[model samples]
Target: MEISDLERIARDIRRRDIQAVYEAGAGHVGGEMSVIDLLAALYFHVLRIWPDQPKHPDRDRFVLSKGHTACALYVVLAERGFIPEDEISTFLQPYSRLNGHPNCNKVPGVETNTGPLGHGLPVAVGMAKAAKLSSANYHTYVITGDGEMQEGSNWEAIMAAAQFKLDNLTLIIDHNRFQQGASLSETNDVAPFRPKLEAFGWEVTEINGNAMAEIVPALEHRGGRPHCIVAHTNKGHGISFMQDRVDWHHKVPSKEQYELALAELSEAL
Candidate 1:
């Protein structure tokens, strides 16, 4: 897909994200909106995968570490034909497979179930190592919330990845600077991510996480060791009222708020 097409798809994804959250009455709206562009670039242009063959062994792996934003992933997966787009309406409903977080067993495109803050990186590291050990030609990518990096497990995986020199692994940190209840500074600042990853023997790239151009290149870059992309992003990226606001982290927008947000996103298309 062309960059222009990806940009339009991202806007559509943002619109879907808002609608899904509004209808479900719950979701990680802020983070979901913040990461849709990155998701679009991956699903549409970067990752090598077939929606019809979700289990293809050679397909690249992607684990959304900040899986509370599963709503956004669902929208992207739906748009990319992994699942029916209409199924999105059932999100968060009782007994619905589209729960608040993704479930790989039930969701077509999800590589693994993820919700716990620090789980995805270790799993992705293992996946990368497995590919290296087995000589499988596949890449492993994981995206984690910046706040979640405070978990010690990620650093352990970091060490193991660097030691193993898993060049096929790509870790993208959605550095939106806000967590559930407050900004990272108010909670625990994990800034200066690039230096830390580089010090751990990984090549690092920092980019405007919301820009389609920046996102695609950052995700596609490869090196001789594990790679990390520090994606600086706003909390609620597409909406005028929500950007950088901590309150939108998990709070449902009011009807008026939703209308305004939808308009702001749709206008971009």
Candidate 2:
């Protein structure tokens, strides 16, 4: 898909994300907005997925480690035809597959159930290892929040990925600066991510996470070792007032705020 097309899809995803959160009365809309562009680039430009054959052996894999942002993933999956787009309205409702966090078993496009911090990388490493063991050509990708990287488990997986030389694995850190409570620098700074990842023997690429042109190449880049893409992004990318505000982490928009957000998103389309 063209970059313009992906941009349009991202805007649509943002609109759905806002609507879902507004209807569900709660969601991580801030982070969802930050990561939608990256998700759009992957699903539309990089991932070799079959909507009807989600379990196809040769398909690439993706794990959303920062699972609080699952609303964004659900929107992307629905737009990609992995699920009915209308089901987005059911987010967080009782028995709805489109819950606050992703459930791989229930969601057709989700590869692993993730909500807690630091889980996606480990699972993605295992998937890459399995592919290596079987000599499969599929690639594995995982996205985690900048704050999520503070978890010790991610380091363990980083060590293991290098030890196993899993070149097919790619880890993208959604470095949106702000965490739920405060800015990453104010809490536990995980900046200078490239050096740390490089020290662990992974090739690191830093890019503007919300830019489709930059995102596509990073996702598709190949190397002799595990790759890490530190995607610098904004918490609320497309909408005004919400962008970079820590308070919006999980705040449901008021009626007036919702209308403004919807207008902003629709304008991008």
Query: Residue 164 of candidate 1: its Cα lDDT?
Result: 97
Q: How does candidate 1 score on lDDT?
A: 0.92
Candidate 2 lDDT over 1-269, as tens digits, reads 89999898888889888998998999999999999999999998899999999999999999999999999999899989999988888899998988888998999989999998999999999999999999999999999999999999999999999999999999999999999889999999978899999999999999999999999989989999999999999998888999999998999999999999999888777
Residue pairs with backbone overlap in model 2: none
True lDDT of residue 253, candidate 2: 95
- For each candidate, give its TM-score against the true structure: 0.98, 0.98
Tens-digit lDDT track for model 1 on 127-225?
999999999999999999999999999999999999999999999999999998888888877688988888899999999999988898888897898
Which residue runs of candidate 1 sit more than 4 Å off their true CA positions?
none
Clashes of each: 0, 0
Question: Model 1 clash pairs?
Answer: none
